[model samples]
Target: MIVCKFGGTSVADAAAISRVVEIITNKQSEQPVVIVSALGGATNLLLDIANKAAGGELLSALQLIEQLRDRHQREAQALLGGSTEAEELSLDISATFDELAHLAEAFRTLGYLTPRSLDAVAAIGELLSSQIVAAAFRHQGHPAVFVDARDVMRTNDFFTKAEPDTDEIRQLAQARLVPLVQQGKIPVMGGFVGATASRVTTTLGRGGSDYSASLIGAAIDATGIEIWTDVDGMLTADPRVIPAAQLIERISFDEAAELAAFGAKVLHPATIAPAVQRGIPVYVYNSRNPGGKGTMIAFDAPRLPVRAIAGKRATTMVKLRSSRMLLAPGFLRRVFEVFETHRTSVDVVTTSEVSVSVTLDDATNLASILQDLAAFGDVSVSPRAGLIAIVGAGISDGSLAIAQAIAALGPIPIHMASLSATGINFTLVIDDDQVIPAMQRLHATFFESAS
Candidate 1:
């Protein structure tokens, strides 16, 4: 069995969804469990409606509702024709919208928009799109079972960023999902939305549908999980920064995860953890051109010193120094404890006898972090920093890779650098504006010149 996940762009309209059906129909024999995201921009629109209503512009919010209703109705009609399936699905879509309209009214009356309320409103996109896609499949003469993901995915009531309970999830997926696939029918699920133990609606944060698919794939112990997005595959570098960026045909799971954690957008950083635990191969493919080889990620693959260059802009670096840290064993531990207390994640770190520097993307907890860190030493924070990470299984190939990476930066000042303990990644923090040029230079040195 294989888990096939389609992102929003792959199911944006009637034509896009039609292509999705074709892909599934071709792979039906593989016992595919289909996962779908919201139609393009639906989540944003739904969230906008909720925000507008909470701000007291119910009229404007309701206008967007009508537009949503029309858009889904048109797509469903186009995909399913005038069949009874299309009409029934149309009404189902409208009914879902009616709930949103009511939610908008409630927000207006309350004059507030809470995270819980926002999740309730935002999750409607996946709910509506999945139902439409399932109906379309049946119209095309395929047996499809629409499973409310909330029924199978159990999470804490964290509202916008609920974390899934794996034990509960595995039991539910086996009991609810396995049978349908065993009976030769496709299990269609809306990705990214789940319910708490008490059934309160919750979202898994942005770009979480990918996480949903990976979790489900692991639960079922499927042969593979395929993530279908706009890009052909993971590339040698960000294509926008390096137009000559070539598709990476294969990579190790650790390398892929490092790239994603640093800056790669094709896969969510959390998407592969569950699958990795289960030792399942995850594939990234393009729905537009399904014939492309895409990229395969697994435990073993061809090892290269520099498989990819990934970088994120708008990062911040924090530096700490003190004489007290000298010969202190727990100094690093205490510094990290401050990060943990504030719930901020440190992406890269390098340390000396009396000083430590770390990079962070989430500054939401910066103020609290700085206050706590000050107890240990002098603390300084630099904003608008960027990180460029070189990911590979061959990172321990001596100093050659590191030298090449720094040489590519040319005259750019490197604020800090570190090689991972596992030797899978080498990272550098620099000014935000220099990220593009740094990436271009690195790509040319490592990829372009090599070709």
Candidate 2:
């Protein structure tokens, strides 16, 4: 069996849902298990409603909730032909909104929005969208089972970004999901939302849906996993940054993971970990243009000079200057403690005899991090920095590739550089304004062979 996951854009409207149905229908003989995200912007709308309600704007929140309800109802009516299935699904959607209303009322009474409450409110979008999509499939004469993931996917009580308990998840899937697949029933489940053993709603954080699909695929030991999304595939560079970016036809798991971790929009970086561990190949395809032969990620793909160029903007680099840090015991430990204290993650780091430079994505917390680091030495934080990574499998001896990349940059000042210990990636730090130019030049030099 194959696992198929559809992104928000693939089910954004009636037309998009129809396309998704077609893709599934074509692969129904394979007994595909489908995972879907919320319709485009639905999650944001739900969050807005929650915020307004928490701020004591009950009437405005109710109006927004009604608008959301109507949006789903209209889509169901238009796409499902006003059938009983559509009506039933609409009632369920309304009921979920009603629960949101009650939660809003409670928030007003409390006069504060807790993280737990916010996650509970945020998860309603995926819950409602999954119900509607499953109903639509049944309406179209397909035997689809809407599986509430909370029933099978168990996690720890880390409310906002809960980590999955793999052994429990595997046992649950074998006992619960395997039978439905064996009986030829299509199990449709919501992505990104799972529950604790106690049944409290929790999300897996941003890009959690992709991670969810990977977890399920790994649990089921499926033949392969397919991620259906907006793009054709993983591109040589983000198309938004470099219009000349070309899709990578095939990439190794390590390379793909690096690209995703750095800033590839196609797949969440963590999504590949489970699949890679299980040696399951993942196919990234375009839901809009289903016929396109998108990128394939596997363990044994042929190594290329450079598979992709990916980068993230608006990064901050913190530099610590102290002679006391030289060969000092617990110096690195103390530095990391500061980050931990402030709940920040260091993305990249470079150290010398008397100075250590670290890059972080959470610039909003830089002040707190700097304050914590001041106990050690003088700290300088630079904002509006960017990171670019060139990932591939055989980059261990990639002197030529690095030379080409530097040549392509011409005069762009590279503030920092680091090569991974595994040698799968070579990263460069540059000004935010030069990010796109760097990506385009690197892609043109190394990966534009296909284009």
Candidate 3:
């Protein structure tokens, strides 16, 4: 069995949904299990409505809901040809909007939007999209089963960002998914949405649809997982920055994860972990060019000298210095404790005998984190920092790669540098203004030959 996940763009309209139908029809022999995200930008619109409702703008929120209803209703009619099934599905979709309206009213009365309430409002996008796609698939004569993910993907009561209970998930899939596959039925489920054991609605965080697909693939022990999205595949550098950036044909799980974490848009950062642990291969394919052989991610890929160069701007660097840290035993530990206390994640760290520097992506809590770190020693926060990572299997062969990187960088001043202990990634810190140029230079130095 194979697991296939289509992103928002793949199912955004009737034409896109038809293309997905063709993809699934071609894979009928593989007994594919399908997962889908919200139709493009629907989740954002839903969130906007939720926020407006929380702010007591019920009329504006209801206007957005009406627009959403019309968009989906039009797509439903176009795809299903306005049959009775299409009419029934339209009512189902309207019911979800009704629920949203009711929730908005409740929030207006309550004068606040809790995380749990927000999740309840947010999950309707995936729910409605999945239902529409399933109906469209059946309309095309495929035996498609609309599996409400809430029934199979059991999670803790975290609401907004619930963590899945793997044991229960595995059990549920083995019992529920296996039979559906045996009957030669294609199971279509919603991504990024789940429910507690008691059936309370919840969601995984943003860009979490990819992670959702991976988790489901792991639970079912599928042969492989495919993520169909808008891009061609993973690229050597951000195309917006480097016009000549080349598509990466194959990458290892670790390399992909590192690139994603550093700002590769092809996949979610957490999407690779569960699949990597299960040794399942993931293919990133283009929904536009369904026939194109996109990037493949697997275990033990051939060692490339440098597979990709990825970077992220809008980062902050924190530098801590004190003579007291030189002989202090738990000084570094204490410094990190402050970040933990503030619920901020540290991306990179470099240290000397008496000084330490760390990079953080979450700048919202910077002030509080700086205050807490100041209690330990002198702390300085540098905003407008960026990080660039060179990812490949042979990144740590020697100091040769680092030397080449620094040479390629030329006069672009690097603020910090660190090589992963496993040697799969070499990261450099630079000013936000230099990130794009550095990525372009490094990509040319390493991947130009392949390009």
Candidate 4:
């Protein structure tokens, strides 16, 4: 059996869903388990409705809920075409929307949104889409079973960013999904939505559908996990940043993970972990161009000095300097402790005898963090920083790749640089405005020039 996940755009509307149905029909022989994201933009709309209601705009929230209800109903009608299944699905959609209205009323009464309440609202997108897709499959004469993800995807009550219980997931999946596959039935489940052990609704945060697919693939020990999205595959650089960015036919799991971590939006950062643990090959394909040979992420990709360049902006650099840190034994520990207390994650770190500099992708707790760090030294922040990373399996073998990267940068000032402990990722901190141009230049030097 294999696990196949389709992104939001691949199942955005009736036309998009038709394409997905066709793709799944062709893969039926493989005993594929399907995972789907919410219809495109549905999650965002749901979030908006939740916030509006919490902010005392119940009428507006209800109006948006009705709009969403209409969309799902329209899509289902187009797919099922006045069939009994269509009528049933319409009722289901209406019931779900009615529940949303009730939730909005509660939020308006409370005049605030808790994380758990927000997750309840956020999870509706996947729930509604999965149900509709499964019904459509049945209407098309395929024996597809709608499996509630919360039934198998057991997770902790982390609310907005719930973490899955892999052991529980594996056991539940074996008990729930294996039978359907054995009986020649396709199991369709919503991605990104899971439930706590006590049956409380929870979400795995944004970009979690891919993570869901990986977890399921690992649980079932499937032959492969396929991520179907709008793009062709992983590229040497983001195509939006460099039009000349070339497609990478294959990449190692480590290289792929590094790219995702640094800023490659093609795959979620956590998507590779479970697949790597299970030694499962992950495939990225364009749902629209089903016949195209998309990128394969495995352990056997060629070891090149640099396989891809990834960049992300909106970073902030925090620097602390103190003469007391020259040889302090626990100084570094205390410095990091402050950040830990504030629940802030530090990305890149560079240190000198008297100072430490780190980058933060999330600065929500910056003010509190800085106040805490003041005990250690002079705390300073440089906002609007950017990070560029060159990732490959062979980066740690020698210094040549690093030399090329530095040479490509030319006059662009670098605030800091750090090579990963594994030596596969070399990152540079620069001004946010330079991220795109630097990535373009780096791509040309490493990819285009050689081509």
Once fitted onto the true fold, the runs of candidate 4 whose alpha carbons sit more than 4 angstroms away are: none
lDDT accuracy of residue 6 in candidate 4: 93
Worst 10 residues of 3 by lDDT: 442-451
Which ten residues in a row are the worst by lDDT in model 4? 337-346
Pairs clashing within candidate 1: none
Q: Candidate 4: lDDT of 408?
A: 98
Instruction: Single out the weakest 10-residue window by summed lDDT for candidate 1.
Output: 340-349
Q: Which candidate tops lDDT? A: 4
Indicate the TM-score of model 4: 0.98
lDDT of 2 by residue, 312-424 (tens): 89899889999999989888888898888777878889999888999998776888888888888999878989999988777667488878878889989999999888798
Q: Judged by lDDT relative to the true structure, which candidate is superior, 1 or 2?
A: 1
Model 3: per-residue Cα lDDT at residue 181? 87
For model 3, what is the alpha-carbon lDDT of residue 188?
Answer: 93
Compose the digit string of candidate 3's lDDT tens values, residues 1-451: 8889999999999999999999989998988999999999999999999899889999999999999999999999999996899989988988888888898788778878898988887888888888889999899889999999898888998777788888898898888887898899999999999999899988987887898899889999989999999878888888888888887788889899999999998888889998998999999999899988899998867897688888999999999999999888988888888888887889988999989999998898888888888887888888999999988889788778878989999999999999888788899999999998898888788777555
Give per-residue lDDT, candidate 1, residue 174: 97
lDDT score for residue 420 of model 1: 86
lDDT of 4 at 294: 94
Candidate that beats the other on lDDT, 1 or 3, i.e. the better one: 1
Candidate 1 lDDT over residue span 6-124, tens digit each: 99999999999999999999998889999999999999999999999999999999999999999999999999888988878888988988988998999999999999999988889
lDDT of 4 at 360: 97
- The total number of steric clashes, by the backbone 3 Å criterion, in model 1 comes to 0
- For model 1, the superposed segments whose C-alpha errors exceed 4 Å read none
